[model samples]
Target: MVAQQHGRRGAAFAAVTMAGAVAGVVATTGCSGEVGATADDRPAGGPRVVREAADVLLASGSSKARTSMEMAAGGTRVTIRGEGGYNFAERIGRLKVVLPRDPAGASEHRPITELVAPAALYMKNRGAGVPADKWVRVDATTLEDGNLVTGGATDPLAAAELLRAARNVTFVGSQDLAGTRVWHYRGVTDIGEAAKVASPFARGALNAAAKGFAKDVVPFDAYLDDEGRLRKVRHRFSYLNQGRTVDVASTTLLYAFGSAVSVQLPPAADIFAGKIGT
Candidate 1:
């Protein structure tokens, strides 16, 4: 299997899925007065601490996730299957992603897919292998426009901000997953119009961005263990055009960090090799 481009920002999709737990209650009430004003408004310290939590999760080991995303705007549903690993102390990581093909499109065409390993982003056009071409390379951290080559469409910057904007965290306590007790924190953020512009070819990605920006506040729910490790993240929202009652849920999970199997960015040359498939 080829390496994929699961940059730092992509990790946000996993870490902040439940960013609203802290603000979930308040978000439902609608934003009034100061947003993060209560005791919950303040961070444990600052962005660094929060970022540290993100980094720790990133550097941990072995992770597996099965996710389902429902989008009202496009009237589509997406399911994601993933497995990866991170060595925090070693700063190594790897992830694999597979997506379903468009039912309306040609059957000869393969589904859009991406693999983010220790190398560059390996995006496969599957059967479509025409015009659009193959893999490209960009910063391991951010997906600037210049980095786009082909295979799959992704925007790193927009994704990162989505995670960064999460604030007003609270210890929602702990829960057991895979036999381990994990601590949970929740928060919220309004990305404003920025989300509308950060389209990543995926409805769930776009909806997450737009909801974060338009709602002027997106809620998140996150879980971590006694060792301060992130276990799960979930995001929820109401479909605006699909009747006020229509609601949606998007979630991501992280596990087994700092383990031997953890994957990290590969050599720069391997990322932009232009290879489309295995």
Candidate 2:
């Protein structure tokens, strides 16, 4: 799909879904390869380390994610920053997003909160020059209907699924991210597996990842902390956005494994049923 030019800055969604927002989390956002792997490097450890981590974290019931997506092309820049958590077992998530400002860069720090529950998607307080009033409620399967989700929407954890399905993984090195020592591994994903979790909104991101892969494998990185918990991930790819192939880099960091994450749809009275469009 062609990228939509909005306001002043380029348009981009984020990595994590807000109730139902599909974002690779590129521009205003959110890389790489390797040589002779090394003694501590595991060329095949990518899948095992990442997959096992996904299994542990997802099964742990809850997690907190901090994501960033950034893309720069055609003399424009777009970015999305979000912080929140999710409960996979409950099929629920919440995110507070700081959207890119208008072209003129005039905007307040109006962070929108997105709540995703089993039955519906709710977006609270959007639109410029508008006051806080109600949350926009949408059907679970149609997250983009109100433009609240902007582009199409998909499950944010699809990235984890992508990693779980990675192959030809190689160990990069060990580093510290946010004070946690981590072992980094890079691997390629199978398109067939990616397609399983992909939605219209995520297709471009996944396809770009595939195109960026070596041997039909788009490389993504997974970081395992000292405790063997998945702490961070980074994905790179190029997408046909707005008729141009724009580069996208996204990062998702998961923490607080097993923490309580209970996201609920706001009360019905707080839901806005009025028409909202771009």
Candidate 3:
């Protein structure tokens, strides 16, 4: 039963548990990589280009997205996937996230619908005794990882914004992705620095993540097209869970630029106000 006195802490903890369940499944394969030219051979303004990825996406409007969040711990690995579209200018997106099946493959879980808006995250079919039709909402800024990992799928726009603080960048060489030629770049981004330079809508959440994550430095590999649009990006993150550090590799792929995206937030009456079970 849901409790009437639910608060941010309970909601945040519940979201983390949901994410952990998705991450806890067993699987194989680690984050993929591509080898390319050395940093010295990188093109001019490599770092500057990487830092401007978020702005490029914003200018381009909306795009369809595919997301993958992979976690490995105790020699066990699992991956959660999502498909959706984002309206960058409005800072809103929607995703249908699918968790991995049981190790035995006997049963599959239902997909969860997630609505991401500025400073908030909403989910349906969250499944811990909450009604199927009721949605659970959490303040993005209150989440330790800033809802980056808590939602089981990173917000595509926020992921791009994270690159705003890229440092020590290098061109990893050119690669063809899904028939498009893209320039590959690798670098490390500081969450604190990004928070300072990120858009006003994302500043608070990034600030929270800067302090919540075990380390503010996140290593990443990003790909961009000729027009400067972000084609793909993979961010490596680590956070403390049960006193153990869990490694997560989150990948976001964007395509079909200028796509139409519609996200409708649930009304107050439809939002579950009761305490979520752990």
Candidate 4:
């Protein structure tokens, strides 16, 4: 992720500028009966099960998603929340993101609607002098973090796809999350490795992220249901800010599988082409 600019400016505009600046597959070979085994039933170890998360979500179709991005900078921490839905099969998602209030508490920011698609991110109500009705588009690969942390909310599908690079994974145990039983797993992942195996739509951006972040290693925690579907995921990301490392924790939750998710990208005419304000 590009270094986020920090100042008295509200988090909304800072996020917009940080964003405007820059910016999975599986194989199974085995006996016919073994092929039917769920991830939990596989004996290859935790990493195998966790690595298959993206494919599981894709097979599940669509789902309702909730995202939270927490950033710590200059001795202050703020959290951004988002609610929306994602079409895993189509690799597109829409999120309504609510930025934190100004540090002085003088004003509340309007919610920004974000569209996450292949190689591009679109935002409405992005502020920073753009018209409310116009969308600002940024190429995902251009972002240092690949839009992972820059947009204030991680893309739902990207979060899952990141698990494709899971390594040193260990089964943390089982727990109930929101009334659903899930198996927990913890480990670290490599962005470059993930990009190599990620789906065509996500490969380019992850590849960019691999070279952009200060470090390629990302620690993560993941939870999955009995059917091998991803229930929740959390990633810890770090990037350089003014020569100091800033930490960002991004979490994504999935539910209501098969939910109808419709995301239509804005037409070219509706995308703001003028310079974005800082």
**How close is every model to the real structure, measured as TM-score?**
0.49, 0.67, 0.88, 0.85
For lDDT, candidate 1 versus 4, the one ahead is 4
Which scores better on TM-score, 2 or 3? 3
Which candidate has the highest lDDT of all? 3
- Mind sharing the TM-score for model 3? 0.88
Q: Candidate 2's residue-wise lDDT over 62-127, tens digit each?
A: 888776665563366566667788886765678776766654567544677777553345666654
Sort the candidates on TM-score, descending order. Answer: 3, 4, 2, 1
lDDT of 1: 0.38
lDDT tens per residue, model 1, 1-278: 11244343332222112111111111111112222234453335443343245445544434443233333324444333333443433333333434333445343233434454322344434322222444433333232112111112222212223445566766554446556665556677545432343223222333433532224465767655555555555655432221333344545455444345534343555334332232
Worst-scoring 10-residue span by lDDT in model 1: 19-28
lDDT for model 2: 0.54
Q: Please, what are the lDDT tens digits per residue for candidate 3 over residues 110-137?
A: 8889998869889888767778889988
Please give the range of 10 consecutive residues that has the lowest summed lDDT in model 4: 22-31
lDDT of each: 0.38, 0.54, 0.79, 0.75
lDDT tens digits, residues 1-278, model 4? Answer: 12122221122223535432211011112202212335565344567879998898888889988888777544566778788999988889999888777667788778889999868888888767788789888777766777787678888888888999999997767666676767788899999999999988899889877876778899998878878888889898877654566667888888889989998999998988765555
Q: lDDT order of candidates, best first?
A: 3, 4, 2, 1
**For model 1, what is the error of residue 219's alpha carbon versus the real structure, in angstroms, after optimal superposition?**
1.3
